[model samples]
Target: MRLGLVLSEAGSGLRRNFSMVVSIVLVTFVSLTFVGVAALMQLQIGQMKGFWYDKAQVAVYLCNDAVQNSNCPSAATTDEIAAVKTALSSAPVKTFVKSFRFEDHQLAYTNFKKQFKGNPVADYVTPDILNEAFWVNLNDPNQSAVISEAISGMPGVDAVTDQRRLLDQIFAVLNTASITAATIAALMLVAAALLISTTIRLSAFSRRREIGIMRLVGASNRFIQTPFILEGVLASLIGSVLAAAATIGIVQFFIQGYLQTAQRDINFVTISEAIVVVPILIGAGVVLAAVSANVAISRYLRV
Candidate 1:
């Protein structure tokens, strides 16, 4: 009987402040949508980093000269190449250094020409002018900086380059976008919380006479409070469900079909993963609304 009465009161309160309830729901829905997108984007960033970084390589170019004590050489002798390989294979860096090899000018030029065969630039350039290079693969690319620094000053080494810088720039852009979405979401969430508080306060004031009468009739604080809290929670839950539905539709239509087809090489997260985030967002909204309503009602019901 107590629970029934509390629920009836909550429903009546929501019905009385329909406009305010709608506003709260819409605000939460919009806010949580952005929050969900940011979360998914962050997850994508992690996935991309995992996929690409593991395949990243550190290229150590060798000098082409024999007598050139300078890192740059006209040609590298057999002994010099052997010494370079031996040093790379024998230390702390050696554990993760999976393979290392010297590529002569001819072989490097062949690869260079092969890659640009269809390009207009290919007509203006030929393989003969390209420099010889050394390709090195590491077991863990994260340890590449250590290897790069170690071999940079070594004899017969021309230059050391790692692919990680490119990956960093790519991931940085995605992270920025994700952060921006999260910021927008947070702002909207604050606005929604304030709106909910205001709405609940208004509802409590309108019901002031009824509440006073109920208290006079021996109604407990819990009885009076439970209904308001439930009203706020219901509003938030509706918003969460709306946001989740919107996210599902957007992912299914915009992301899975349109964006994926347009950017064939880029992989986006599956719709199923996106749907999973909805519950979490909804839970957050419910908690925010409940707390805000509780705080707003406390001052009004102090009598």
Candidate 2:
């Protein structure tokens, strides 16, 4: 019941079990770091999906004179390209097509070169060999297949590609990575719980004789158990704080500092999103530690 005594006991227990305390802290930090990473990964995926889907376009490629495609009987003429544009702008197909932009062979080649600037193969291609295309923005991204089908087999079209399909594949990979992180986080949490329980058990057994003396002095189980539980809670709280700091560093350095500059076109989870997860991880760590400690004390210390 005495606050000073309870705090003194907690301090002594932490000092006596310094190594075990450090282990608990490190384990909790790592486990919660994985948790945060998994969350951020999901956030990243969601942000990307929203960003890309909003700008989804179907590319209807025109035939290149130098290439033979089943969809292209011969090189598409300017008139055919014009006809495709007219179709996209008019009623039958226009309802699905929000708008369209034409990329000539030179523009397509320029983009390709920019995309693969360092690749050896890029230098070998010429604009004449590249196909022009209509980048068609759809009223609804989910209707990409409909737009692609409508444009396919048209006189000037060589291929009708849906950007949404490509984006889906990319998102699928991100989702898998998120799942992997969550799996690792779950496994590490199990390990952390075991370690926390072990730490509490060790702390109790080391002070068993003292605990017996306290019992003889009419101390209740709650009073006897408070310090040990507090020890675990404090260690876990420390670890959680460290984990939050690490998470912030990752978002700031790797994501904002590096990736944002390196991949300007890609959208990612903001620093605010990363920060929002910190309290959740901290609360989880505290709860996890408290539960593990209580269970261990009840089992080993008869409390």
Candidate 3:
């Protein structure tokens, strides 16, 4: 009987402040959607790092006739190439290197042609113009800096390039995007909380006479507050469900339908990741609404 009365009062409050309830729902929906997106972005970044870092290699490029710089004053001689080969097999650096393959001029030119197959620049390139390189795969990708420092400034080495450096730039951009989304979500959530509080205050004010009557009848504060809190919780619950649906749509249409097909090489966040985020969003919304409503009602009742 008490539960039914509490539920009935809660429904009455919601209907009385219909516009405010709708506002809370919309605000929470947008805020939780941003939260879900931010989470998925971080997940996508982690997946990319795990996939790319494992395959990244350190490439030590040798001096060629076409390259004339302080690092490569002249084309690398056979003796210089042999010196580089000996250093690779030696200690300190050798232990970190899992395996190394030397690509000669002809092989390098062949790869260049294939990479830039239809490009006009491929026509101007030849075997003699390309630098021979040693592609070293390290046991730990983080040890790339150690290998780079060891091989750099050698007689035949023009440059030591770690593929992870390029990957870092990509990851940096993704991190920035994630931070931006999280920031927006936080601001929206604050707005939603304030809206919920305002809605609760209005509902309490409208029923001040009824509250007084209940107080005279020896009703407890818990009984008076339950209905208002339920009102906030119900509104937030609706918003959370809408946000979950939107999140699923993004994963299905934007991520899987478009990104997976468009960028076949990259792995995107799937529906499973969205499913994981849904519960989190719903919990956050419910908790925020409940707390905001409780605080607002407590303050109103005290006065």
For all predicted structures, in order, the TM-scores are 0.80, 0.94, 0.92
Give lDDT: candidate 2, residue 296. Answer: 91
Weakest lDDT window of 10 consecutive positions for candidate 3: 147-156
lDDT of 1 by residue, 100-129 (tens): 777777788777778777888767754445
Q: After superposition, which runs of candidate 3 have C-alpha atoms over 4 Å from their true positions?
A: 113-129
Error of 2 at 197 (Å): 0.2
Which of the two candidates, 1 or 2, achieves a greater lDDT against the reference? Answer: 2
Candidate 1 has a TM-score of 0.80
Clashing pairs in 2: none
Model 3, backbone clash pairs (residues 3+ apart or across chains), number: 0
Cα deviation in Å at residue 204, candidate 3? 1.5
Each candidate's root-mean-square deviation in Å?
3.9, 1.7, 2.1
Q: Give lDDT per model, in order.
A: 0.82, 0.89, 0.93
Cα lDDT tens digits, model 2, 1-303, are 899999999999999999999999999999999998998898888888889899878889889878886767688998998888887877878888888888987899989999999999998999988888899888888888777677787887888898888888988988998999999999999999999999999899899999999999999989988999999999999999999888888999999999999999987677889999999999999999999999999888654
Show model 1 residue runs off by greater than 4 Å.
62-94, 100-125, 128-131, 154-156, 262-267
Q: Is candidate 2 or candidate 3 better by lDDT?
A: 3
Structure candidate 3, residue pairs in collision: none
Clash number by candidate, in order:
6, 0, 0
